[model samples]
Target: MANPHSDHPAHLQHHFVSSEQQFDAAKMGMWLFLVTEILLFSGMFVAYIVYRTWHPEVFAKSAELLNPFLGGLNTIVLLASSFTVALGIHYAQKDNKKGLVINLVLTFLFALTFLVVKYFEYTAKFEHGVFPGAAFDPHGVSHGVDYATYNIPYARQFFSIYFVMTGIHGFHVLVGMGLFTWITIRALKGEFSSAYYTPVENCGLYWHLVDIIWIFLFPLLYLI
Candidate 1:
């Protein structure tokens, strides 16, 4: 009793010649999408650089309002998340379903932690009427934080850039959490294994990029 369809995989698309070809094509597409993401973020980075160059003193003084310790803690959390995701991928490749599920869950928790921390930071800014755009108050020191200087319009430029850049990055992190949530359910159902872990692989690549973007953001936004 021989099965004729055994040579073909159920997950393979009809357009693909083979599963390997399908995987390669999917990876290439993900890379292309990541390139577009980089380009988008690059524009923001350039804006930040231009503003800082034009007004270095404003940028530095405005940065004093930020909490570097919180920024550094978030950086560590995201790095841990990236490591857990890599482990999840490793477990998937090894067909260790339990390990994959555990690692993915860990990654999800870490992402949630990042967002929670960001929420507190946002609330602190709000408490001082420090919002983005027209609502922004350059007098962040009105709460008596610095109680001197920093009421100039140039300070608005720094906070505006900070909010926009970090806001977009936070949205990406939220999306990553959602993606991991979906795939973790799949992993629990034994969807991923050595021969068919394309979803996990692609998601990990995306998560890593999210982490890398934050790495650049921390020093640029919080530190000198």
Candidate 2:
């Protein structure tokens, strides 16, 4: 009888000396990356909080301009995606290649849906001339489309921070899409197995971090 372990190929890195080691390394690196990501967004959040404190009225008025319904929907969408991503990692751990692929594909689709919703949100803002800086001049636009008329002095400043925070978050989503795409291709080729599924696990961590960031962002930017 042939040895089952021997059947597995050795395309993985030698630095780790074992599949589990490589997987652990990947997870650790991902956590480090997530820490850096948090720091990156923290700066923006701090700025928002300071500005909100200085101009509480502006932030309050700006909050009213946003539709909590849409924000709630997006929050649900992201939470579901996070659950799917977690399941994908579980499947990969069991060496259930088919299950892993299915979950990953579903997660990718969820990401796409998120982008679509975001597109509509961004379009609505643009049509109303609610952009940052001088572009935010809603000279002759009507508020019949999106609720709450926006023309306050500090309202523009509030939107400036809003756009910057959400824009950066959206950019992260785009980057994650590319990362997951690469992981999916690798998975399709049977690259990950019970012995070596670090890529899947690592990517899963990355996905979760993305979700975590949005959790805070939703409330701060939408609710509060």
Candidate 3:
């Protein structure tokens, strides 16, 4: 019997039975990648739980030094970026190239804003002598804030977890920005449309996953 999808678009691989099949396959692959990401972070979360359990007081006190205001601002920025990406996908589906491009640019800008805020937060920590591992030393005054007061037993554990988690999250944000830039270039060249937007859709899914990770990290590292 002749294949029903033999006339599928160029973007649809010849091996795929249909466009829907290809799309589903791509989505499934993306979900698998997201699952691996979760598993990777799960190890850090377990370490955090164990250390926090052993030194709840230290964890609480150390967390106090972190700026919840900046964390909250980053959370808002990420969420807004997620919304913009969703809007970009919607515009792509509607064949509105201008809307899609605008939303993607907005999303990229939001991601950049989040990273900039994180830079200052990290610098503030470093200036206060809040280093992780053996270099862990909170002494002297920096940025008009004294770190010696935060020198509690096992406080290093808390800062270690903070740096590792936030560092990984920041790396993911950088990657997302690069992905958005590539997509934005493609978007400018009229590469995506209602008929084919797999790249944009996949990128959106990845960005959402990154944002979700931050949602979890914020409360665990900043609030709690």
Models 1 onward score TM values of 0.94, 0.90, 0.94
lDDT of each: 0.91, 0.81, 0.92
CA shift of 78, model 2, Å:
0.8
TM-score of predicted structure 3: 0.94
Clashes of 3: 0
Report the alpha-carbon TM-score of model 1 versus the true structure: 0.94
For model 3, residues 68-150, the per-residue Cα lDDT tens digits are 99999999999999999999999999999999999999999999999999999988888878988888888887567678989
lDDT string, candidate 1, 1-224, tens digits: 39656778878777889889999999999999999999999999999999999999889988888999999999999999999999999999999999999999999999999999999998888777778888876344544675236557678888889999999999999999999999999998888889999999999999999999999999999998
- lDDT for predicted candidate 2 compared with the true structure: 0.81
lDDT of 1 at 156: 80
Task: Tell me the spans in candidate 2 whose CA falls farther than 4 Å from its real position.
Answer: 1-11, 139-149
Ranking by TM-score: 3, 1, 2
Best by lDDT: 3
